[model samples]
Target: MRHFIAVSAIALAAGSAGAQEIAQADSDWYKAGQERIQAELAKTQNTNKARNVILFVADGNGVASNYMNRLYAGQMEGGMGDDYVQPQEAFPYLALVKTYNINAQTPDSAPTAGAMNTGVKQRFNLINLGENAIHGDCAKVSGNELTLFSELMTEAGKSVGAVTTARLTHATPAAVYAKTANRNWEDSVPEGCTAQADIATQMIDAMEAGTLDVALGGGARYFVPKGMGTPNGGTGHRPDDVNLIDRAKGLGIQFVHDKAGLDAAADNAPILGFWSDSHASYEADRPETEPSLADMTAKAIEALSTNENGFYLEIEAGRVDHANHATNAKRAMIDGKAFADAVALADEMTDDADTLIIVTADHEHAVAMNGYCGRGTPIDGLCFDVAKQGIEHSDELVLADDGKPFTVVGYLNGASSVMVKQDDGRFTAPDGRPEITQEQAQDLDYNQQVLIPKDSESHSGVDVALYAKGPWAHLFDGTIEQNVIFHVMNYATNAN
Candidate 1:
């Protein structure tokens, strides 16, 4: 539990003169502080049963990534970005979640998301399976399958849905219903692993069994047989002749391939939409043929709300992870903003009294924000010199030890290394950091400089932030194990 001290009371306790001075100070900052404290003090926790749950996950969105996104979003709105408030940041309850897998320190999306969905820490690269299950061995997975919140919600008569910017069979979203020993078994498994079904097959099985009411995302190829052409100008990836797209249609699921199809989908029918052959385009590069994260969120809510038992939906901005891995800060921040927009739309669509909305990340990335740059510095551009007088930035740019300007945002290790690969296949460091101009650094295609050389940046073993509101939200306070999120959701809905 936490307690708050009134602003005036604290000042008066200091001294009468100090209290009078503080009260007389009518600056906007002072007034804003007082008003915020009052709002906090007046807030009352909702203890009712959570009729609905919407888990909004931004994959690889760690604390540092979130800070960078905030500044970028604020600057995009024509303001100094530090003070900008994202929609989830305004939630009444928050907690720092320790994201570690049972077998690994720095976790990947599979076990981390599995922890949230199944209420237990799991092995690396595994989906909703018990710790005893081997990563790719199917023989040990039979009784070790863990129950996910999606299953529980469906059993309780609630409508269940999942939407992501990544493939529906991707690790994070697959945790919603999949029970597999390996995350990579999306459309096919390795040789000799015949006992365990692929993730896409499991999802379709759930939908066929009436467990999943809505499914939308990018991996159209996984659902169709090889040699089959998709609406996105790409062919399918499945090795077998099983065309899951046709099977979905035969099951009476409303299948949509483009934004137009999604728009015309029947209001009361089950929906399965695939907007891209692979992961959807980064929010900044999205085309008119595809819907935004917010659009998918709105459609999911509308389709599920008709159920009297309410719904459980998981919405993931999975492209943020891809951008971070490639050290593309611009696309990462844009996708993050798109995620915030989806959260805002979901909040507006449901009543807080009956809905439990949780906004969090499955894991943090190695991307970091560096330098003591001045206020209003372009988050995706080079760091600038600080202004000594006011909130505005100085005209000069900050230079690195190499006498060249560096970006405000960069990855700890990624594709943009100073070392170059030679014809002999040896990576050799040439000279110092490359000369980076502000215009070049701010380009949409820019890859931020990295210290270590790797094909892709890695996930960081750090605590990610979780923001929640509505029923039982107060239970999420201070620091907690990532798996506790599942327990909190379970208790909130079942306790009543």
Candidate 2:
């Protein structure tokens, strides 16, 4: 076990203090770290049932992604790119979540979210369905459906809600209440499948029954009729012309569209804020009118924490996953910042003794930090081989055998594919892509070169990390299956 990370061990005597004084200060800090390790090791486990629980997911964030985002966050705070700490990283308990599906090595959001939210590992593309269900068969969904954690919490009289930067009907948020053979059944019911309800319908049904207390996110288009884009930039994607927004309003759900509407939401009733048409814009590209991820989280907590029976809230910064799929690091990093901000705000809002807060991810992406960089390297810049320079004590560029400098950030596969126009109007590449300059490599819009070029990046098969604090957080100390998250929440809140 890592006793403590020497994150604060830096140039302590840069200008005033002498080297000996710095050495003595380092020794004192090391002693303090040892004392802190013993204190943590001796802490008694708190077994009390929590009054509130919050699950914060940075959809596809992984270890490398966390490191890069920490650096970016630090740089944003006027510090070097290294040694930055995210609020999630400050959680007292940590564990690794193995994120494979029932049948595949790499899992998608539907099954991963199902595992974390339902206590059952499911197949890819299946939302809240057990392993007994086939991927695309609707008939098997009845017997194979799994009860989601939020549903169980609601049954136990706890208010339940899901907040995401993605659509309310997106996979992560949808898994909290949706049960379907296919995750894509968010807007359309397959032809002739009259028995199945779409995801948005499920949210309304749950709200009408007083189970869902807050449902805030994007995907306003799917709830309304077609050609309703003018209202909120939506395509009005519903084919049956059923205006679900009107239904929500009729059911007494506070149907909100913009920031003003969200701010004016009735705390006495359920708040259903559909902020955008599709997925909300990335943080760096968002409009001022749309509420931020942190904004929604704070509002949901303010609205839900009033219940006498407590609440179960799911907060997702879903655009991080979208930016990673698009292989846009700058956008992803900014979204990561937004996610961390939400976590920190939540941390401030609730006391660690009575509330159980868990921060985790559904899966990982194929991004990596490459090349040898110097200390304080700009995480968004090109990689430099600092070690290859001579002992002249001056910085020098280290080139590859091909005499090229690579970037600090790259993906295993993404939009970095190279294609040469063929003579017959097709595209093919006989040889691989040529080397690019540092300037070209570090551009914010540049798609980092990858080993395999894909239309969209793939999910990583690696295990993702989970961080936790508060009551029952020690339940996540060691490595655990992804589904264990649901069980831990169940046990912590006594929702069973």
Candidate 3:
């Protein structure tokens, strides 16, 4: 029940001109909230002593997604129940994180994830290379610089690992290991650039250096040959006939492509598992195609925990951001719940006293929950009242032109009555009924369609929540900058 707010000086300065007017409008509420935040921060005490750290990034997750997941879970349990039934509710320590890039009004994943991974603020597209990154030439950037994972592993003699649903070369995952000027230069050369250091190359380097123990999740395409079919039959290729899997094997790293392969690999061998070419599918969508995030987390822990020195692992639920970008609240919530499930699994597998677990998001999406639709609302409930003829529901719900419900989520930019069924096995909005759809929803233009002022279903400048458990959890009370996560993890792992 303790709440805290930490607004930046920039926000405060921006509001100063109109501060008197706003104070007159909501003076009591604002002052009360501020007082409450201060009191909460003052009462917080740091007493945790963690030896290992596991960080989970629910890419674009925000406060709204957290609450919505709780509400959906509560509704599933007959409503008015505790939101704690959702996995995130189990964490005892929480904080608010300020997510903003050094240069952009709206931040991207590169710098946002980099801030958490390195504890330094850099230009928007620069990864772990830090602020010294040149716009076009990433090779010139000094990347051997310390990452939280690298620093921890070196200081504690612990192993390090990174897992994600997206390509291991993607921004979130790469921030933990690879450094580059641009995020999109996965395995490909950057435009007009000579040196190319994709995430796969970095993983191999880490493996060779004996610092990284586990590297899991998609982007087999960057590790294998083009002719070879990916784990999913798609092409998995590297440009120079460089089979990263072979390179990993040359370094005595165990490479696995499927669940069975992972299961059969030697327990003590360092692992490099690439299950897909790109991001892995959602649990509900590709239940059989790939391993769930929970499965991957369990495997990573199993592989790393064997080291006598402990380990640092970063697990990302990257698809949650994709779902949010599409304005699919149900999908986002479901995926978010699954991500939390991975955290719970990690909590159970590792000793809470020795393992530090941190759950947070890079940024927030512009998804907001309006008034509730009333209890006992059928799965196929009508989104709007029939009596209000010609009055459309908010543009948040994705409907079909034929009136068949395709998706329950809608976007803020595009106008589409075409309903597309979600691949996930969830409820779907029924025609003319206020029902939720089984398919994920899309983001819509809140301004043009719903008369809401948001331009696109874009990332918000609002603060995000950080939930932690295990040792050092108490340090997370109150509000802090997104980069503080690196310091917390470093402290927990005894990394300098």
Candidate 4:
């Protein structure tokens, strides 16, 4: 077994900073530090009323996740990854957000996103319902339904939309409008809950009732019946035999299933689009036919900015969470980069003076950055020894007590256990950790080593960071409960 103290020693030894060998009076770092302070002092608070609000959620992107993303992105651009700054990191104001649900310390998606959509915390597995509502019980949903931020903005005559790299009815996106006792009720309800509308139907109902102006993402199976085939070469999953896609068509909503369709959509018409049968492809595996997260975000802004009363849109980089659960660090960081690209495009398209652009995460994961490697280290590769006197890394690898190299990024526990399975189907641990090569660890499909075995990675009980710009961004000064996100939006928009 590995000792925590040994791991800490490795990190401390490799990451220890040396005393300055050069004069600090004229160094660029010293001057730049002063310049940054002056820039901050020059910034005046913006008190203008928000005309548009774009809430960007990179699901499962906690502080650690964001740090890893920054390093990966910097290395990709030929820099010492540690010093690179993401677009959201340039935001004028920020706060640390507590993400625990009412019933769980290690939070899940449904309640965390619900806490941001509604100004209160609820039990685990519930979405946009009060704390009194019982999870999985439809009867308790009637009076306990919470009014969502999207709903209030819609009632104020503002255009509303939701865009994600996930199913439109997934928890993070669903929190935009749908109110249900259970987040799992997307296309089908339980036996006793058949009287209630599923999440997919609720999305359509919002569009039909003029509450949602645009809807985009994957999960086409939920819109049609079991016998109906989706454009993505999959059959539907709806148990009720009702085709919600056709229902949207009958209601005059323009439905699209590909990038070409999304690009050619009439600017004046409301749109309902799905890029795949299930969740959209991961950023690295995405095909030309599917629109990127940035593409969908641009289309959403184009459609929603037309309303004079303004708009509210929710965009999610949902695949980051999925990849983390699978313990795939490369895909997770790739998706994280794509998410940052979307945020950049959104910021560029809208004026920060009048549009409140918020970037946050619903929760954190159990991912860890280990072996305090040298600067410019390949984030997804095996950890290398720190440089003795130069800024660049050394050629030698950092071996553990077992004389085996480990990755810089790894999960505390995940599917990739140290144990191997025998022909008899029983799992067994080897005498020592396996030897890992740099090339093998750097491969796109490599899974980092794990200490504890689990079918999937779990969420961490940690705080996530929130970045904001535009109206009332300064209000996010100190640390806050997750629910304060909703109140900040409500204050910026002045929506009752």
Candidate 5:
């Protein structure tokens, strides 16, 4: 409700840019844009070797997601949102990364992240392991285990850490250390796969071995005994009777389950922390005491930066993917904004000359920016024809062929596909999906009308953007396989 009020006020303050008079493309103001591009072209690359690498991932944040999120952020700051430039956009090098898995054109989190973390693409549902492993098969995972970028950096004696808004055992973060045949095997091994390790077990094993120094984020459920909650009141979903928190203590890791604990943990000790039973709360609805995406990042950096050997850290805003799956635009964009804020904090904490910061997505979702609603229009608003095709001053809704007005944002497929017409002629989807809005099409509850109806929105095979700054960032200038990110980081860290 606060978001609705705040964002609604933001929209009112800026109103819509449709009211502004048009300027010719060849006008004097256009020269400023031309000059800016020339200045960018004249800049030289920083080819220095990197001492540290920080990778920020906004899960399911494709080009459209990034653009719309930036636009919304601008509005929140009281400007025409389109005018806002994201920190990632300031990166000197940018490129597209193809996100296909070995088996599917459109992949899920496991395989795509497999590429970024392991330097090789693999079959869907497989974690940091290689394609030699078959999904859901334990016996096939033997020599198929892939070497992680974190493993390489750690073997080089550098500090390594991972932070995420998702469960630390979630595919994206787990790819840094966990190798499993099934991504869903976070809490327990399957009935037949008990001989193999779960994601949580692999993470603890890695931490105990001293390869992963700072581990922060959620998934407390997977570390404790089933039928029990942590002493801090978190549910324990681990099938085993062993309490890994105590085990972590035995291994000299300072385990924390809340914000105060997180802040109090000294940078000298190895840390294993989680503030939620599963994934951290959505940014739109996070608890005050739960560490933010930026807080986790800042703390992880503070701890790891202590290593004279430098550090490798991966911070993932994984809730963006969850939001999109439920077709919640407000939550997704808010998570993206949270991600940008984290990047801003990283920029504050590290210098570009020695630290390489990369922002990218593992894969995309079935979402896009659609309909022409004029510049400065609220990105989540209904399409309006206030100034299209020479109509200079008419406050009219842009009608579809069936005479029903559509929205600026749309989806390729999702649960919000059907609209039940309301009393005021607005529409609403049932169940609110992950969250809800009273009005359909543009409200936070609106699902951005999809063409296909399914349980949830699906992933897309389309390429995602990779933006970088700092040493060897120039290597990101060309279109690349998603796995190439690993190569670039390895080369930048000189860990290859």
Candidate 6:
């Protein structure tokens, strides 16, 4: 019995010693891993320490659009010389991201942007909240609560800013700060929600909370009082309502309305610049009514870069989607180029090795650049004029050969069949007659007003491309889920 007890004690001591050795080995492995990470982090130049993160969102932009833009900018038409190759060619880090909503195969800006901002998949038409949240009721949602901007700036002590060619309260921008199930809560109230918070309320709250350092873009009417003429000569917000400009002032926000005002504002001060009452005009159609996307981006970087703690700025070129929906190829391409120009500017301004810059799209459009429209010969056999062809504005009406009165393009589902037009004023279909204007083709007696084409263009379901530069850019190598973007940004910014 004594021998047996001694044997048992010996075995227990041996087991305890082995356990202690294993624990020590694990501790050593952990220390080694941490040291390796620290060494890697130390090798990065302080200039590349990422004092600022700039995310440029080209709304509805896709791989096709990027290729198209490259073609246009390079003037690479018909195997032309590569003299026009832009600097985007050298972008080494690229990834493809999935962009589907929880409820829809072809996602809209609401949920797609929500996924990008909140790092969570959400239902269609919802912004910044999970699928189960009651529309416009932030109280119902649980578990999925961390917003990239809120998490980075509030918890991680980074500054946050947003700039867009669309309204600042629009889906893409709102996803960063506002929490609502329905994205359309700006103009209409959602079911089961008591507080119908507009873009103005979100902006004010962000400003008052002292997290949002810069807010620039359109949506002037939401900020102004009623009876006052908006920046676009439209009636402003309701009279007797709280003035957002004053509210911004109370929160120590430096409000600016025009380009000069924006330029004059101190870089250190928080800025609220609203250039238009609604969305800024497309880059192709801007006629004193809007600021270019590039301009907004440059201004935003200048304003946000002054922070010592680093800043997170979101710049959105939002009108490309609108043009794509209208099926206006020229407008879409031009707007996309304008957005790209903004990215170029950002690349130049934030070239510091530590600044992380990401360029991507929320979704893609159904627009495709098919093969060559013109014949082989440039002069004689070329039946279509590439430059002069104007698209039929609507698909409802058709133009007569004599250019006298409008007729029907064709009939589809009891609606007039619409045809897309090229730049040379030639229609796509062989039987499609030339109309006086594209709008004439669109104006038809139908159930829905076919804006560009009779049925309207749709968004593509393909994954979109993501381009990255600066610190940790190598991390964006493989195709990834949409939510992984948050993790990348979280890691890049060193957000805990």
**Which candidate ranks first by lDDT, i.e. highest?**
1
Candidate 6's C-alpha runs over 4 A off are 1-49, 76-89, 134-146, 187-192, 237-240, 288-290, 372-456
lDDT per residue for candidate 2 within 362-479, as digits (tens), equals 9999999876676655677666545445422114455556676666777888776555455997655666466777677666677776766678998897888899998899999677
User: What TM-score would you give candidate 4 relative to the actual structure?
Assistant: 0.94
C-alpha local distance difference test of each model? 0.91, 0.83, 0.69, 0.90, 0.83, 0.66
After TM-score superposition, the amount by which residue 478's alpha carbon in candidate 4 deviates from its true location, in angstroms, is 1.7
The sequence of per-residue lDDT tens digits that candidate 5 reaches over residues 409-493 is 7788887776544688765655433322325555565567776777789989888899999989888977899999998998888
Instruction: Work out the TM-score per prediction.
Output: 0.96, 0.90, 0.76, 0.94, 0.88, 0.73
Write candidate 6's Cα lDDT for 118-170 as tens digits.
67777877777756666556456555444555555656677788888888888
Candidate 2 weakest ten by summed lDDT? 7-16
Compose the digit string of candidate 4's lDDT tens values, residues 1-496: 3698887666544421321333673677876865786678789888888999999999999999998899989999999789999999999999999999999999889999899889998789989999899989988888888888888998888999999999999999999888888899999778877436899999999998888899999999999899889877899999987999999999999999999999999867789999988899999999999999999999999999888889999999999999899888999999999999999999999998899999999999999998868877799898888999989888888888888889999898889878667688877775667788888887878888887788998989799999999998888878899999999999999923
Maximum-TM-score candidate: 1
Q: Candidate 1 on 27-133: residue-level lDDT in tens?
A: 77776866786788889989999999999999999899999888888988999999999999999999999999999999999999999999999999999899899
Candidate 2 error regions (>4 Å): 1-39, 42-44, 387-395, 418-442
Q: Give residue 87's lDDT in candidate 3 (0 to 100).
A: 60
Total clashes for model 1 = 0
Off by over 4 Å in 5: 1-28, 192-195, 386-394, 419-442
Sort all candidates by TM-score, best to worst.
1, 4, 2, 5, 3, 6
The predictions' CA RMSDs to the true structure, in order, are 2.8, 5.6, 10.4, 7.5, 10.0, 15.3
Clashes of each: 0, 1, 34, 0, 1, 20
Q: What alpha-carbon RMSD in Å does predicted model 5 have with respect to the real structure?
A: 10.0
Instruction: For model 4, name the residue pairs that clash.
Output: none
> Which scores greater on TM-score, model 2 or model 6?
2
